[model samples]
Structures are given as C-alpha cells and as structure tokens.
Target: MTAAARLLDDVCHLTAQSLNRLETSEHFRVVKMLGEGSYGKVVLAVHNQSASASVCPGSPMALKFFPRATTSLCSFLREYNLSLRFCTHPSLSRALGIAYLTPSHYVFAQQAGLFGDLYDFIVPEAGVEEDRCQRVVSQLSGALSHLHSLGFVHRDVKPENVFLCDAACRWVKLGDFGMAKARGTKVPEVWYRSPYCTPEAETARGDGDGAGERSEPEEKKRGPRVWASVEPSVDSWALGVLTYAMLTGAHPWPQTSSDCGAYLKYLHWFRTAKSPEEELDLWAEPQHQGPDGTPADFGAKEQPSVAPQFARFTPLGRAFFRLLLNPGPADRGRPEDALGYLGGAWVPVGERERLEERRKKSRGGGGGGAVNEVKLKDGRGLR
Candidate 1:
C-alpha cells in the first residue's frame, strides 16, 4: 500500500479502538438533529458532565456525527486536529471534544452557531449592509491569518462555511475545516471542495480536461494523486469571491450551467487584458444570448439587477476587493494585508463616523443608541 493508504488504515484501526472505549463512557446526550449533510448528521447536544469537574455542566454544543460508510477517516481527523489547534481564536469555531460512538461512527462536539450560515442570512433584494459586510470579512481575515500562521490553508472558504453567533450577525466565525490542508503540501486530487474555488486551484487540472473536474490515472482513482502546490493564497482567492458575493447579491462570474461553466468563464476573464473592475461589471449584463440578435431576458426571477451593486462600494472597499481578487496568486493580498486595510480608512466613512457619534452620545448621557458592536464571549472585540 502507498503511504497515504497505510496511514488511513492505521487511523481506521485507532478509531475502532477509541470507539470501544467511548461506548462505556457517558458524557454527552443528543438533543435533536441540527443539520445533515452528505457525509454525516449534526445534532444539538449537551454535556452531561464537564470533561473535567472544574468546568461547568449542561453547556449546549453541536455534535457532528461521521459514519464510516460515507465519510473518510482521514478528512475527519484533519478537521478534528485542526479545530483543536486553532480553537482559541474567536473568529474560528471551537472544537470542544471528540469521541468515538461505534466502530463505524465518530462524534465531534463543537461550539454551536446560534444564527444560521452566511448563505442563509443573505437576501437578494437587500444585500448585506456595508458595515456588516466589513465586519464579517474582517473577522474572516483574522481567522484565515491565524490558520496560515499555524501552517495550514482552508481550501474551501464560502458563505456556507461562515457562521454567526447571534441573529444580528455581530459576531461571525469560520467553520468546517474538512477541506483544509497544510501549506506547501501537494493539493489532494480526491478532496471535496467548495464551488468558490481559487483560480490557481481551478486551473491546476490533472488531465487538462477542464477546470473543477478531476482527471487522474485509473489506478490512482481510489486515493487520487496530488498534482498542484498548496498555498495560503488559495484561501485569499476564495475570500475575494466571498467578498464579491456579499457586496453584490450575485456571483462575480456567470452562473450559467451550475457546473464548471462558470469557472471556465472566470478563466476566460482572467486571461483577458481588461481591468478587474471592467471584468466584474460584465456580470451585470445578461450572459445567455437569445435565439435572435437581442440579449435574452432570463425572466425576472432568473435575472439579477442590470446595475452592478459593487458600484456602491466605497473607493477603499473597491481597492480592497481588487487586492484580494488579483488573478495571480502571488499578487493576492495576505491576511495581514486585509487586516491592515480593514483597520485603515478602506472601510466606509459612515460606519466609523456613526460609531464615533454613538460613543459621544453615550458619553453625554444621551444613552447608547442602536449601534451594534461585535464582541466575542471571551470579551475580545472584533471591531
């Protein structure tokens, strides 16, 4: 067997042994199903007793159950280990504990996100507020920076993976590390990745078939070969795509066939000599040509607004997006760069001015207004 196959075999054996021990322990009780995915089911859970007596009991948590039949042991271990390593960060989800439930099952308990994911929170009619968008992206940058500092890159970063702590979305955290990989490592061919993939990743096709589709030798089908170099910039690229989605209610690239067609369009745009802003503006136009010479109306339900919402972004905000969305991976902004931009005057002036005005009113005994501040449970402030 190859090295990776051997390692997977070892993990499977160890997992079986761990589950045997956990079957005798009684530390958690399942409440109800929270969500279900292709590989596993997540459920609301409560700790019966703290992992230690010094800690409190009855704390609510989320238990993600992975069945051996559908989920790979290697991916589960990667997420579990990474979660434990970076849980201290307020913007990253905390993995409280892990336990084996059965020979074919394992469970990981993590901090529950009260509000749903960013994908659900966004609305087409009204895109996310500029201030709120800045806050979410800022926290995500911090999380990505922390992850990079730990020598890892989140291969998948999208709205579905971003979670809110409250209904107001004042505190946001990045979760779901199943696709994360170590920096400088060879990109795994068999990995499951989000559609909001980086250009580098999309272009690194094994067989030159097309972007986003896997091409490998028949013998390598099981484990899949690693063909591309992994880097921290992949995460940055995904963040750029996410930023565009949040600012505008639609995707930056065309959403034609719901397959790799959009990625192909992105590739074409990247090769074009046109400016980034001009390329982005093309999304506002109807892509699908009609049978006649005129532009085809995809119908009111299918068509996004012709006017690009990104025009509303402040000058600095536009610059920030450009920095992140640079077609060249080496040219993309690092997490620290994003943080600096966010802390600087790149954000909308109204947001900072409004916060300052709110502080003044509170100091003058006018009482605090409806101004919202993003703070973590540990008392650390995001902004």
Candidate 2:
C-alpha cells in the first residue's frame, strides 16, 4: 500500500480507540453538538476528569468527522498535513487528537474553544458598539500576523472561521484550516482557488462534454496540463476579501458564480499593476461608502474613513496589509515575514529573570492532557 494509504488505515484504527476512550474514560465527555458544516460537525465536549477541581473547569472542543468520499478524503489529508505543520502556534487552534472511523470517515478532536465563531462575537445579530469592532479587528490582526508568519495561508479566513473564548474578546483563534496550505503547494481548497482560474479550474468537464471545449492557446502547447492552474497569490487575494468582510460583514466583491470569481474581479479592477500603497486606496474605497450611496465623512478630507478601531495598529499593521494584499506574489511577504513584523517591536529583555521567577513561584501547575499518538501501518507515529 502507498504510504498515504497506510497512514489512513492506521488513523482509522486509532480513531476507534479515541472514541472508546471518550466513552469509558472520565476525562472527555461528549456533551452535545455545537455546529456542523460541509467538512464536519463540532461537538460540545469537556474533560470531566482533571486534577484541578475548578468550577466549569472543562472547556468545549470541536470534533470534526471526515467522510470517506474521494473529495472529503483529500480534504482530510490536507487538514492533517496542515495541523501537523502549524499546530505549534499558541494562538492557532491546537489539533488535540485525530482518528479515522472509516475509510471515508475520521474524527478529529480539538479543545472545546470559547464562544461561537467571530461573526457572532463581532456584529451582533442585534447591534454592537463600533468600539467592539475595533477590538475584534485588533485581535484578528494579531492572530493573522501569527499564521502568516508560519508560512501558512489560511485560505478560508472569514469572520465565521474565527472562534472566541469569551465576551472579553481578548482571545481569538483561527479555525477551518481545512482550506489552509503550505506556501508552495497548488492553492488548497475551493475557497482559495485563484480568482484567475480558467474555465477548467472552475467548471468540471464531463466525458459527455467532449475534449474540444478547451480554448486557451497555452493549453495546446502544454498538452492539457496548462488549462486550470491554482496559484499562491490566490490566498493573499482571498485575504483581501476576508479583511473586507470582517470590516463590512459582507464580501467587498460582487455576488458572483464563486467567491474566487468575485475575488478575481476585485483584483482585476483595483489591483492591476498598482503598488501596495495604491491598493490601499482600493481597500479604502469600499470602507468609505455608507450603507446608502453617500460616502462616509472621515472628519478630515474625503479619504476613506478607517474604522476607529484600526487606529492603534503601528506601521507594521499597515505594512502587513500591504504585504498580505500585494497585487503580485513578488511583492507580497511570506507568512513568517509578516509575523516578524508583528513581534518586531517587542523586545524580550530580562527573559531569564522572568523564567527564574516563574520557576521559583510555580512548582506544580496543571497543563492540558497528553496528545495521544497514532502509529501508521508503516510504523510512523502521528503525534
């Protein structure tokens, strides 16, 4: 069997064990279903058995079940690869446990996170203060800066993908790495498909359609391989759409055939060959408009009024947006580079003093449970 296939088989075996552990062990209890999406359902689970006895000591966890369909299997593999690559980040969601239930189904258990997605926390379905919006943006900026630094592209970076810990709104974690990918790979996931996808990339050609529907001259030269290519800038472009969405609660681009298509159009219209500074003007235009046709008053000139909440960002934040939303990959910064900008200003002086104090004061502190490892059929351990 291929290595990937064997790994899948091994995961399937371990998934059964994980489920059994939950059923019998006192640590994690499956309470109820939190939410479900095309990828998997999240459950409200907690650790019933912990050393510390604190009120509501246990938190909720998301249990993602992967189906065995050809498409879902691919997604399952991608999520696993991504989790292993970037799970070390404290701000990013941790992959606590992974197990496969069937050839087509796997259960991924993670820490029961804080409140629901960021959408609920940001603009209340009812109403919210504008100050609250600023707080959300700042926290998200920090999280995004972290992910971007790890060479990780969160392809589906929408408000809905962010989860909150409490109403204080201090802790924000990025979720749905189902669409995330390493920088060099073919763009991962439908959400990040290049806005420039040719017809072949967007539309699946059936055997009934015949082969002659292909039209690109490049396709003829490349002999069928050049038809639909997914690109890396695709994620950066998607980042622009996401930033616009969090600010306005709606996609900046038109409602079109696909998010990718709308994004591509947005890019073509505003990003053509503009420098990063020029692209900010494009980002500002949408922010400047009111719900109605009139432009918003920024108190100064006719410049787009940035949400007052975004005011605290240093030049690094602006630089990050410029790098992240750069029209071309050549200008855009890598995820790690962007992260460096976020932490660049903070100097960790007296770190040894801090560690010495921590060590002296805290002798025994509680940490999270151990992450169980699953061995692949080939004897590789998935930790």
What is the TM-score (0 to 1) of candidate 1? 0.66
- At residue 238, candidate 2 shows an lDDT of 47
Worst 10 residues of 2 by lDDT: 374-383
Candidate 2: lDDT of 65? 65
Write model 2 residue lDDT over 1-383, tens digit each, in one string: 23433454466354434442233134557777776655556777775543432224465566666555534445665575456445555556766544344444666656556577655532211122224434554555555565555555565555556677766556766777775654445421221122222222334322122223446774464354322233445555445444433433333333222444544553453343334345334345344533332234423432222323222222234444556655555665444444333432111123223433443333334321111232222121112
Give candidate 1's whole-model lDDT: 0.60
Per-residue C-alpha lDDT of model 1 across residues 120-202, encoded as one tens digit per residue: 65543234555677788888988998878777788768776788898566799898887777677764433223335455554
Q: In model 1, what are the clashing residue pairs, if there are any?
A: none
